[model samples]
Target: MDGSITGHRPRAAAPVGADGLAARRGEAVERAALPAARRPGTAGSESDTPAANALDGMPRQRTARAAAATPTALSAGTVANATAPVPSALSADPAAASGAPAPSAAPARARRPGSPAARAAQAVGRLLPTPFGTPFTFGYALVLTVTSYVAGHADPAVVRALHQASSTDVAHLVRYPVAVLFASALWIVGGILSPYAAGFLLVLTALERRIGGVRAAGVFLLGHVVATLATEVPVGLAVWAGHLPGSSLHRFDYGISFGVAASVGALAGLLSPWLRWPLLALFGSVLAEGLILLDDPMTNWGHLLALALGVATWPLVRRAARARAAAPTAAAA
Candidate 1:
């Protein structure tokens, strides 16, 4: 049995020739090249060579390095996106996108000093405060009072010169229309004091306040001119017909009484019935007494004519009142 076993072992050894030896060498080289984990039937082996261990550890080291670098790459990309500029179309306000407020627009330029607008504003400012409040009427009264006071107190030559220069005589009216109009209101009665000053202040100031400055001026001028012409024309005709002397044409026909009477008559219509009727009666009675006494027939007739003209202004006043009443409704619409 020992001999037989020995004989089988030798026969198996004899079959391992040079070709088989070369094949075995090739198998050894392949095994050396491959990782131990990849070697057949040795996947879970613990007794591994140092080269096999290094080969296996290479893949683990690379994976660990790649995992460690992932966060830094992602962080760099995130920072790049966050720092990028926003497009104008994407943001309604470019300043807001940049975390800032929008800049304010520039202010408008100021008006020049010598401009028409500035001049007009200055003129209105100067005129608005005249005569304490009623600029046009009271201011005119102040000027008239001052001029009359000056003329009455001045030398005889100065007074005479002023009278000649400011005369409202029928012969002078054609040459000095403006001068007559201004001078007519500057007369001082009895050569010492102007009685018309107080009347003008009271009547004109009130009238100007009720109806504005423009209309009050219109009424006063209209009354003064119309009354002067009416009274003087008749006197001229009477003189031409040999009823009076030619000296009537040269008479000093000037005063604010006619205008005052007209204003009083006009304002009567605006007053309550109680006040209006009383004023009219008083004025009419005074005028009638003057006429009946034959104390200056021309003057009384001129006053009556002026009063008629003033009463005619009621239509204008009513129109203004209606306009004022409708203003609020128009504004709301």
Candidate 2:
């Protein structure tokens, strides 16, 4: 029976060197696979790295997460202190906890040098008059007051001759454009009690406050010059065309009415919604009535032209108003 049994000697217990080497290779494979099994998106993903592989001193992706989930013999309070978050402000700045003051932002510039904005700002803080807040208007009215007083006391014949000489008529403009155009604004047609006086006082004061004195004066002068040219140029053309008599060239026209009318139109735009339309309607009605009457055609046409001229300055004056509004704050700073 022993002879019939095949004796391969139990396959010689599989050579110890080969068996041991296979076992060691199996262990290395398990170690390498351990971290991948623990990574995110798998059933064993509680840790991003192998907790046991720390013996190799290999770097971990999320050491804190791995350490937190690891079984520990330490007390709960100890674990809480280990996991507590550090404030970002304190963590980023080492000195923040010591109470150092943070730096402040730089202040705005006081004035822009040599620009039109600078000039306007300077005019606002410097030339803006007090009690009235209208240096240009105040000075102009004062000059008018003096001239009115002089004209009231002067000889009537002399005043009449001066009015004719100063008239912005075709004859006078043909002789002296600059002289007559400027001289014409010096006298009121009906003295200080004229409608132009009261209108000028109220309208220009409000306009000067919104736009600086310089802009307000510019608006006045612009209307005065443009309106004078408008009315006189037509008369000069009429005389040349023989539409009217050559005697029309010397018509008596001297006053601040055109400038006052322009100021009234400019002031109306800055008024509040409720007051704006009413003020315009009232002023426009007054101008329209005199226009309809056809009394002193040149003067009536001039007043209407001045009003339209001032209305066209809305965009200009709105920009000036914003600049003037901010100037005081900048100057104060």
Candidate 3:
């Protein structure tokens, strides 16, 4: 300590509170006495600290610095310009997007029921399909057939002409057209026969649509021709084999009526299971009538043979029905 580089006198190391200890201790006591001022760090600060000046002049110094940095002396015109309301084009319109009147609504027209255009549209629509099915063609056929029958009887010459025309010109047309025409004639004179004829018509239409028009017509015609043969062949064989009586086949009007009726019976038989009770009742009633009436020579064997033929043709019918069912299932998938 005596041989130091410079002749500096040794000063005694001061105790912890050497700088104004008495005053600092008094300030600490005062801060502790007042609850608000007695923060832990605030009680023991040095007199010449930068932190003390920051704490003392912080709010005033900040206010002055902010005022110096900003444009405090703006012109009255500039203030007005900055605060002024915007133009209408710049502002958003509440109604335009959703609430305003729609352009489409303004020109839209309401359709009236009795209008000619509406009636025409309805008439066209009826030609498509109904809840039941297409009945228009059947209705038309019925009218033609009835008019030909009753009126043809009135004038034999007209009946002859009709037969000639039908055989020469119209016979080549599809059998369904002929059948519908036949049904129409039957409907006019039908009376109690309406139910039978109607059931026949519906069955035929349903079958025809399910199978194709051509195949359906073929099935119908097959049943018809076979039923005719069933009746005719018997009588022919009876006469040929010398079993008995006068010619029965020639005696009965083995014309289109019995053949067509047989076809109807066959179609109904084919459609029976699908119709449930209604079809069963229809079929049972027709079968009973054919058996009981026995009035028409063709009637007895006609319906029975047709029903048997229908049962025989079930393979084709079932195939068609399956295809129809599968079509919709495929479409949905």
Candidate 4:
């Protein structure tokens, strides 16, 4: 060998064990397979490993699909819940849940007979009896028509005698108290035609319904007797005082006008405000006219007096009605 080192010569050095050689080879293969970014001591290389990348990519792909499908599924569930009816069993009533009877299952308390409901029922029942549900009213009209017809056909002497007997004069009151009953209802002028039949039917029937037949009759009689006495007494006193001729005692006076006026007055109390006011106004105007005109002094005065008596009877009428309403309830108890 020349000392000038003309050719580079290989030098055989230390020999390695089999185990060490195999370990070195395995390390080299692992390093070659790894990416540069994943090599040790590289920034963020811990997260860039193939196993970590695969784990992260698998979850992200699955989550994206889940998110996209979630809104559609949520919307469908919401619509289903909104449109679906709740089951009756699920909507339990508090009472039923507590083992108590439901309100609909419980028996209703019995109503007292005199209660407003009972009165209404009774009134309905009464209404079913007649067209206007007032038999007395019809009877009165029938009687008037028959009597009028009889008077029309009777002899002149007999008709005159009937008029005399039926006169409501103060001179006849003491001796013929019975005359008071018949006198006030008789029509002396045109017979039944002198009185308004329609007015009588309507007024009397309405009064009877509102205050019952008994009270209605009381009101009529009270008006008739009081008005007649009131008018006749003044005339009697005037005649005795010589202010008028004695002929005033025999003044022919007979009609149902006074009773009609009183009935209207009593009805005013029972009527609602709307009807009451108009009725009072109308009656008041008529009375005022009579007073101003002074055409038939006695009759006008009787009408006015009768109206006053009717107004006075309001307390009694109201009390009776209340008692009637309460009677059924009291009886039930």
Q: By summed lDDT, which 10 consecutive residues of candidate 4 come out lowest?
A: 55-64
TM-scores for all candidates: the values are 0.56, 0.60, 0.44, 0.57
**Per-residue accuracy of model 1 over 1-333 as CA lDDT, tens digit each:** 655555444233345688877886566445444454654335465544566555521222123344345443244556687766555657888786885666777877887569898889976554432465567776776666677677767898987777776667767776776778777766645532544555566667766656667777888877888887788778878988999998877877676778877887877877789998898888878778888899789988988888888889878855664665687799999
lDDT of 4 at 97: 57
Which candidate achieves the best lDDT against the true structure?
Answer: 2
lDDT of 2 by residue, 1-333 (tens): 667776565433444587777885555444443455654423466543445444332333334455345454244777688755444553555544445544456886787569898778976554334445677878988888898888899999998888888888889888889999899989887888888887777788779978978999888888888899999899889889989898988888789989888888887788787998899899889888988998877788888899998889988898889888999899999
TM-score (C-alpha) between model 1 and the true structure: 0.56
| CA lDDT scores, all candidates in order | 0.70, 0.78, 0.51, 0.72
**Residue pairs with clashing backbones, model 4:** 113-329, 114-328, 114-329
Better model by TM-score: candidate 1 vs candidate 3: 1
Off by over 4 Å in 3: 1-196, 243-249, 252-274, 328-333
Candidate 4 residue-wise lDDT, 229-273, digit = tens:
888889989999999998888877776777888888887888789
**CA shift of 238, model 2, Å:** 1.0
Error of 1 at 111 (Å): 42
Best by TM-score: 2
